[model samples]
Target: MRSLFKRCMSALACLLLALPAAAQPLPYHVDPDAREILPNLQPVPAIRFLTTADFPPFNFRDPGGELIGFNIDLARRICIEVNVACTIQAWPWDQAANALADNQGDALIAGLSMTPENGELYDFSSVYLALPGRFLTRAQAVEGFRAETLDGQKVSVRAGSAHEQFLIRYLPNIERMEFDDELEALEAVKSGSVAAFFGDAMRASFWLNDNLACCGFAGEPYFRPDLFGDGLSIAMPAGNDAVRHAIDWALVRLKQNGALDELYLRWFPVGFY
Candidate 1:
């Protein structure tokens, strides 16, 4: 009876110890050398990714109600390569940023650009694409255009965007009308509520070709080094080294395998950047 009691106590202690280890979150990293030799090494589990579904050509909800776009497709591919299930949640762009900050999602796969202000709040993956900004105006608005054509003209831009920051710093005298999304900004331009709308060249081209019957690029493409960073990248909340590493590795693999190039061609056949 004494021996059996001692054996039972020992088994309970071992089970208690193992329980804690099993309940703990998986470590993000493993020793590379050991992992290389151990084929059975497990990866960190998948976490949800949040994005705004309004940005077309990057992430948008299709008529079929599926989240479908370049970024969405790329993120799904990356998750597959990493052997994790990725859940995409659509929220407003600003709400998505807040959700990422609050740890509601593992990362933001929207067409997020790496800017100094944003970098202060989050970690960023290597750039996936480089696109220039363009100015769109009604064809009649360009009739008497000069170097300072946009001066004093009401311009619509997405609030808190790189274009907004650029205009604030460089074109301070211009009347600025900020919108929550590009579609809204385009609407403001189309309705004559604003004289012009400034955004990515690809997006502007998309709008002009698809939506705006009388609007087109008014001037040469603008590339400001200080305002727009090298290109757009995926964003993860600050100090998320594990998630960042996995995403970076997956992106590099996609680029190397010609998947990214193929995606660009398929989405933007006319070419961007």
Candidate 2:
């Protein structure tokens, strides 16, 4: 009887030992001393970042099918500076907000726009890049293009994007076709199925310049303070103060040291402005 009691206690002890390991949350919180180290001496967590691989000049897969772009490069650099092991996991842009909210990844570093609605869903790092909305259409479709020009035209925009909201608010005359991603919108325009598409100017320019025969920038960019917000920011789960502070500090330091400018030049040799 004593032997059986000893065996039961040993089993209970083993279970107790395993419980803490399973219940422990990911170590997203940084040490106070680590912050003092600034860009260095910070222990990098082994983390995966979710991003939309289709958004180019910012984040996308190269000809070799490996992820490469400005955001991807910047994320890698940030990981290096913070001394963290990181990987970029491609996900649909529309799904990124939910993915991070669900804790599927540590953060979303895609060229995520900072809007009030999004702010309610996730915390954001400091703005890294400012982008404006632009129209994309075939060159032949460009003449006399205006908000009025969209009347009765089929327009494509990625669902859940600010451009879609802009269209619904201002250009109700146009028939808006919602897509799961900007790539799908671009494909519709390329295949001549959609009259025009709206997206970030940099993304539109990259696609138009690269896929010259199919599409081109149609008109000057449209900007509204309320709809677009300030610019693009890295997204983390709401209340992730540690990650936010780390990223904000990293951005400020990089900009101050001109590293951010060098990165911009490396990607946008002609300049985005």
Candidate 3:
């Protein structure tokens, strides 16, 4: 399950490759109608967000050793929306959760899994981003690629992954060629060894932009929150309703006013959606 939070650690490469996809629409996870009515605090408490710097595009250090990424930017935006003082700090991934539990930070925005066990320990803000499974196929094969149409066709996936399990559970008819990692599975598609490959959209987007010039995304992205798990949410100390509610309310406002979409486009120029 921890694999859900695993991400490529090449923030600089991703940033260099990111190109504006102004022609495509961005994905929205927050509902515009979702609003919170919380008791107003005369002086709202400051929020300190804890994160790790290894996950590229989400949280990572730039060339100057300054922490910067999508999550950092979003955390600041949430603070701005709620009119609260905010500070972001990066810790080693292994120690981040323990630090949060030790009262080192008010919230964690380091892609914490919203699992039942964690739900008991932390109050999670509404899911801010959900990664989807997508198919990457050779340019020519994309013309008529359809999930239903690929009944017995060969497709590559990482061995024993959630993506592999998803294929086994849903598209059982397809002949799966499992690889030990995403790059191998993608390579099978690039070399025409398989008709397509299925895996995490974010990683695939990075590869599509950086390597694997032979393939492109095919069909709409598949969203199985039950299988993929809730994508990404800010985790706060359990029962911290004030902070949680404020962040949730700010997320809704961010989506409604287009600030969130702007950030999405800026970070994910080749958007997974």
Best by TM-score: 3
Report lDDT per candidate.
0.68, 0.68, 0.83
Q: How good is model 1 by TM-score?
A: 0.57
| Backbone clashes in model 1, listed as residue pairs | none
For candidate 3, write residues 133-189 as lDDT tens digits: 999899887777788788999999999989999999989999999899778788888
Model 2 C-alpha lDDT versus the unseen true structure: 0.68
The better candidate by TM-score, 1 or 2, is 1
lDDT of 2 by residue, 168-240 (tens): 8888889999998676788898888989998766555444434656666676667665766666678998887
Q: Candidate 2: deviation at residue 117, Å? A: 2.8
TM-score of each: 0.57, 0.55, 0.92
Question: lDDT tens string, model 1, 164-249?
Answer: 98788878989999988677798787788988888776655555544435776666566675666566678999998777777777
CA error at residue 234 for candidate 1, angstroms: 1.0
Model 3: lDDT equals 0.83
The TM-score that candidate 2 achieves is 0.55
